[model samples]
Target: MMFMMFSPYSFLFFSTYMLFMFSLFNITNFYYYWSVMELMMLLFMGLSYTLFVSSYSQLMVYFLIQTLSSFMLLVFYIYNLPSLLTMAFLMKLSMFPFFMWYINLIYKFPNFMLWLASTLHKLPPMLMIKLFSLELNTNILWLSIVLTVLFSGVMMLMVLDLRLLLVLSSIGNNSWFLLSQMVNMFVFLFFLVIYSFSLFFLLNSFKGMSKPSLVSSMSSNPYALTLWVLSISGMPPFPVFFGKMLVILSLLMTVDMNYFFMLFLVMNSLMVMGYLQSVMKYFIYIYSSNIHYMLKY
Candidate 1:
């Protein structure tokens, strides 16, 4: 099961390496669209399993591809080369006006797969953001911030499923928190622990209730649902809540008041909405007459 889930990501890395190599020698178009960035990302996940063919060779190739693609994008942005470069960066980062691939990918993947992709694959973009922010003007930073928040907000509003909505909300929150620049290794490690625990609990509960021919057990199994929901929602007592709070505090300390406030409110509001929707849906399913119907063959 784990292998099946991670196969796409490895395959994607391999394919991205191939594409990057192709781009290096074929210099006709020095610039490419942001959509190419999205395609590279898609390919990375879609080809994740290819790593098994030759782990050492493939891993080296994957790293090289990632490095080259990243460098090219950086040069494009740093040189103030062209709008296409900025667009490519935006696409790579899954920002607005080029966010369709992100939404579609999340919808297609299972909750666990979605979490893996979002959390693990975010390193490149985060590195890029850190690099760019150090060199770019405040205007560019703010623009990137606005686009990320808006794109996430819109997707959260549109997605009906609880998992996908949470994923979207997480992306927005991650973007806003990252802009703060005060986030350190300890904070990231803590967030990882909390996120992993919550996701594990949720997946376990889902599996428990999804047993064949079993009626929806989430409501009757309030303890399980409550634990999962509270952890995921970043409610008090969970590491995520404290981590997120610190991130907001850091944002307040680093960025302007207005930008911090705007991002904080929007991201938190979406999270709250997603939590409420999840709770409501579970309750509805629990109380509905169709519960038995859903479970029956």
Candidate 2:
């Protein structure tokens, strides 16, 4: 009865999400985790149907891609084929080379599906990395991160869509995730939680609206929205900074390719600030006009 305060759809979605997360943490058997995740994906597909019938095709594409990733997982389980597990997880998350399909599918997704796919659907693979990421070659991970940020920067320059921009922003934040993953085991989990909260806070502000939602929310809660942007961007004094700071310190301990890591740090910083600048442009223009209009009237 208490949960009935929200619409049934809202209640169901929230409940399913919480359950999925709970199971993700508690489950140890690989097959069990895989089965639970597949079930959650099916539930999300059904839930999306209630509100966004038109997104059926995109969701199916997502499901099929995920199934392919799982087949990779099956091989990894059976034969342990050369980081196939890692590749499967990254492919599922649409990181780096696999981002092409996500780019194509993301635009067609309705707002709700976009939110779930970007934020919630990404957790399982992240959990897998936490359990087994240390064995990865550090140089390769950093190189991929650099490439991801570099590619996202070029695309960020040409995109005007808020959803697309946010998706690209995740490309940068995920670099931090991998850094923290390798730097310290618990730190990865910490950054993941903070990053997810910031993203959820940012996207939830959309409140199920179209492209102008950021401006609309800014007009009402400019300070809150602005701070969320800075936090997500890892601006100093925000919570994300501590996690990143730890990673930077740990990175300094690695002597090989120190210059390369420095380049990555600089490029990644610029990539994040690029989005921050765009957001600030909106805030300054919109917030200033709102203030000026109020003062004049």
TM-score of 2: 0.80
Candidate 2 local Cα displacement, residue 26, angstroms: 3.0
CA shift of 158, model 1, Å:
4.9
Candidate 2: which stretches are off by over 4 Å? Answer: 1-10, 107-115, 132-140, 207-219, 250-260, 283-297
lDDT of 2 by residue, 54-139 (tens): 54687778778988987787677667654665566567777777788887876566555565666567767766666543244444
Candidate 1 residues lying further than 4 Å off, grouped into runs, are: 1-72, 77-87, 131-134, 143-147, 154-158, 180-185, 208-222, 289-297
> lDDT of all the models against the reference?
0.54, 0.67
RMSD of 1: 8.8
Each candidate: RMSD:
8.8, 4.1
Question: Highest TM-score, which number?
Answer: 2
- TM-score per model over all chains: 0.63, 0.80
The global Cα lDDT (0 to 1) of model 2 is: 0.67
lDDT value, residue 163 of candidate 2: 60
